[model samples]
Target: MITITEKEFKQLSEYIKINYGIHLKIEKMALVTGRLHNVLIQAGFKNFTDYYNYVVSDKTGEAVTTLMDKITTNHTFFMREANHFYYFKDNVLPYLTSTVKDKDLRIWCAASSTGEEPYTLAMILDEYFGMNKIWWDTKVLATDISEKVLEIAKNAVYSNERIASLPAHWRAKYFNKINNENSVLIDKIRNEVIYRKFNLMEEVFPFRKTFHTIFCRNVMIYFDNETKIRLVNKLYDHMEYGGYLFIGHSESLNRETTRFKYVMPSVYQKI
Candidate 1:
């Protein structure tokens, strides 16, 4: 088995931090080694230095893409953080429905890992609007840095165990049973989410209209304080006035530095 040396780990971790804003601590060395082991071996790299070199020097960008895929953890389930969804439905959706005069409602799932979060939002939107959904545009924008997860999310298939936490009514209404073990999101819900490959560290967000709601949960734990603040401010700029931002329950914005008013634990609003 190959192992990453201290120097190689530092260099590679710094590269990831600088380019992707994902801060890796000294303790994550073993995790870095474990995740990248197969990629290095398959690419014929004998040491972490060689793998790091290949990742930086490759002009096609696929090397770094693969690096990101392995390094980032995409561990999420349907309704992983249940309270945020409840608040979104109870408070945020009502505000949006009342104020969005144009009838076009926008929501962005900035850290959409596989598909569950965005699909859940889509289902809620469909149910909220019900028959009136025909007259309104309510597509959810889902994006992630990892193409591997994006492809899986786009497929919209989940194993029975993966979806066991979702409400039973939702399972029956929004998914078609693929088998005893797997189910696929129905086209009605699937069509309501648009998935894209996006990196939050990108200097400019490519969007024509600001979103009414943005769910950027869980992913910020990988970033250091400065990176997190920068990302939070960036998200602020891309939001419509009175828009809601739902972050992970574990994450908090610096009270003084952020413009978003705290609405509740892990929930903020642009006012």
Candidate 2:
């Protein structure tokens, strides 16, 4: 493997941080090299600097997409964070049903990873609304930075092990067994989620509608404090009044800097 030099590391690190809001600490040098070495060879680049230049100059942005897929971790599974789903179903759903007169429920799974969180949320929404779901616009907008993962999300196929944590009824209702027990998300549930490639570092959000709920779980841990604060404020601006924000259980907002009302650890309300 071609070892990344100090200058090469700085170039790649700055590019990632500036374009993706990810703070790759100096200690992550080994991680960066490990994750990217294969990509460098696959792309036929001799060294890291050459790869960096190609990523920056590639106007189609496919190179950057590949870079993101290689460098970032997208580890997620069904019911990975169970408590947030409980809160959304039990408390948040009730509030939206009562208050949003038009019943157009706008929910954004901001960092949807490989689809577990958004699909899980979709199932919860389907169950919560039941037959009444047809009467409401409950489709979820699920976005991620990597096109690779977005493709997986669109396909909606998972190994049995991946769906093991899902409730039995949800498994039965929303998934169809195929290829010797691998699960494919049923079209009814799969169609409910709109998947897209989104870069959170984009200065302007460009969302036409303010979301009633945003689940940006686990992704922000890669960001530094300032980046997190800026992103949180951007999320605040894009949310409806009284909208809810769910972060990773381990992630928190500085009460002094953010506009979100403290609801619980990893949960906040836009008031």
lDDT of 1 by residue, 94-153 (tens): 998899999999899999999999999998888888999998999999999999999999
Q: On residues 98-172, what C-alpha lDDT tens digit does candidate 2 reach at each position?
A: 999999999999999889999999999999998998899999999999999999999999998889899898888
The CA lDDT at 129 in model 1 is 85
Candidate 1 has what TM-score?
Answer: 0.98
For all candidates in order, the CA lDDT equals 0.93, 0.92
Cand. 1 Cα-lDDT: 0.93
Best by TM-score: 1
Per-structure clash totals for the candidates: 0, 0
- Superposed by TM-score, candidate 2 places the C-alpha of residue 42 at a distance from the truth, in angstroms, of 2.9
TM-score, structure 2 vs. true: 0.97
Models, CA RMSD each = 0.9, 1.0
